[model samples]
Target: MALMKLATTWERFILKDLTKFGRYAKVELTPPSPGELGQVVKGAGGFVKDALTFKWAQATVKEATVNTIVIAEIACWFFIGECIGKGSLVGYQV
Candidate 1:
């Protein structure tokens, strides 16, 4: 149990760092316009709304921004679940 806890802790730390790094990298790579940033935020908001209201599972970002948005949405959900006393779980379709 102790080892499992330690591993989970380490994994979270790594994920946090990687997320920060990715955000910084994206900012440096292409500074998005206000509209683009708004779109991303809107996309994430829609995702959260759907997730909460209907248990919907949808990717927040479109194909072009998949990597960045997916990472960001996962981080957002992690923080949200931590705050709300729930665990993040997604269903798998066969």
Candidate 2:
């Protein structure tokens, strides 16, 4: 009985460790492809340009709406970068 208990404990420990590693492996990341990298660089510039174009000196409701959209677009770009970098685009619906 004691040997059985020891075996079970060791198994639990090993399985727990393996599960943690498996979780980490769920998102295997590869280096971005050349095209993806280029897009990321270009997207960063577009983000900066959009922010600069906002007329901070004359704040208005319309500009605020546009700013929100710009934020969403930048967020999308970042998501794109991550997906492409991780090579996780397989069967992913964007």
Candidate 3:
């Protein structure tokens, strides 16, 4: 019984060390392909179109204008942020 217990303890220690080593492994996220980028742009354009239509049909012009402007601004900033992130990634690769 004592020998069996010793063997089990050693096995647990080895597995713990392996788990620690696996935690330090590197991970990467590659850039999207041209086709994928095109699809994303198309989707964004569709969203802008929908927002415009909704704004035009609203009962209050003031609220509609504000919402439309906010949506457009957010979409522009999202694309700009993506470009900046890609630029930084390129620098990291070099």
Candidate 4:
């Protein structure tokens, strides 16, 4: 049982080390308050709506941005599906 516990701890520590993106770590920004974090999260939720229906916002939208929306929607849907049932993923070390 002691050996099993050591192995498990080693594996978790190695994974946490491996997944880090060191560039972002160097930035010196204060952590968001809980309320600010919630608002930021809520703002991010608009990404899907903007991607799906943003062309409607303009009288004359560019063709490239319109095309990007279709691609974004497909990619976001795949990410959503992947997130539904999975446990841990590349989201570690956050």
Best by TM-score: 2
**In terms of lDDT, which candidate is stronger, 2 or 3?**
2
Which of 3 and 4 is the better model by lDDT?
Answer: 3
Segments of candidate 1 deviating more than 4 angstroms: 1-28, 55-94
- The digit string of per-residue lDDT tens for model 3 on 1-94 reads 9999988997899878877767754322457789989999999999799778885575488877887899999999997887787786344434
Q: Which portions of model 4 miss their true places by more than 4 Å?
A: 1-29, 56-94
Which ranges of candidate 3 are over 4 A from the true structure?
1-56, 88-94
Candidate with the larger lDDT of 1 and 2: 2
**TM-scores, all models, native as reference:** 0.30, 0.39, 0.32, 0.28
The lDDT per prediction is 0.79, 0.84, 0.78, 0.73
Candidate 1 lDDT over 1-94, as tens digits, reads 9999999998899888999999999879987899999999999999788778865445444643876778899999987777566433443333
**Per-residue lDDT for 1-94 in model 4, tens only?**
9999998998889767755644456453558789989988887777667768874466456766876898899999988777664645556344
TM-score for model 3? 0.32
Ranking by TM-score: 2, 3, 1, 4
Worst 10 residues of 3 by lDDT: 21-30
Alpha-carbon deviation at 38 in model 2, angstroms: 2.4
Candidate 2 backbone collisions, by pair: none
Clash totals for all candidate models: 0, 0, 0, 0
